[model samples]
Target: MLTVLPAINWLSVLVAFVLYFGLGAFWYLFLFPKPYRISLGRSANEPQSGNPLYIVGPAVCSLIITLTSAVLLYALNVTSYGAATLFAAVVGGGYLVTNTVNIAINPNIPRPFLYGLITGSYHFVGLLLISLLLVAMR
Candidate 1:
């Protein structure tokens, strides 16, 4: 019974994807531009890249994450609000946060922990919202 296709809610997935991507935009651009730059070991005065990949890449990733979370929520039959929150927390903290920290542990990321803290927090919150929305819409 691994088929989650029939249980999927496309509308919720769309809304959640928007919320997830929108949150990323707000998080990086408005909320923590300076701190994020510092976490990347870059100065405020440094020239930012205008590459489309920067935008497109994360959008794709967010969509994937959203869709995946939606499938899991439906497949696992997480219907209650409290259960959704707990599931989100577990998935967020366990996979997203841990993976963010792991990705940051590289030579390019001078302040790995700081970067992890910033990005991981975004994913954590995004997952929470996504799961909640999915459950609510279901």
Candidate 2:
């Protein structure tokens, strides 16, 4: 329910979005494609369908996690910009490292580590940008 435009630092948000999107692009282009193809036994060049469930479901989840983390960080009196960045990095990186290991070790799990990677990366990038914004604003 937070009004992102007015309530949050727009510049920071933009930076986070860019960083997270870049990471996603990297993830898809480099880290995930081969593993995903291997796991699903699909051709490397198979066409992708624009499924609503696949897109919207994960997006909603990412939003929830990012917003929740931001709010919680704020509530905990860690609203400083540096704190936000560090929080995002710790939370995001932690989630990624944990999930990456889990998926890498156990490839049988459904959906692999795609969901966690996406969600965690978003949170990480968002928090990092917010933290930068906090510093700039200060």
lDDT of 1 by residue, 1-138 (tens): 449888788999999999999999999988988888999999956666899999999999999999899888988899999999999899999999999999999999999999999999999999999999999999
lDDT winner = 1
Q: Would you list the C-alpha lDDT of every candidate in the order shown? A: 0.93, 0.54
- Model 2 misplaced stretches (Cα beyond 4 Å): 1-41, 109-123, 130-138
Misplaced by over 4 Å in model 1 are none
lDDT of 2 at 69: 53
| TM-score against truth, every candidate | 0.96, 0.54
Model 2 global lDDT (CA atoms, 0 to 1): 0.54
TM-score for candidate 2, please give it: 0.54
Task: State the lDDT of candidate 2 residue by residue for 26-79, as single tens digits.
Answer: 665576666555445566677655678765665455455545554455455465
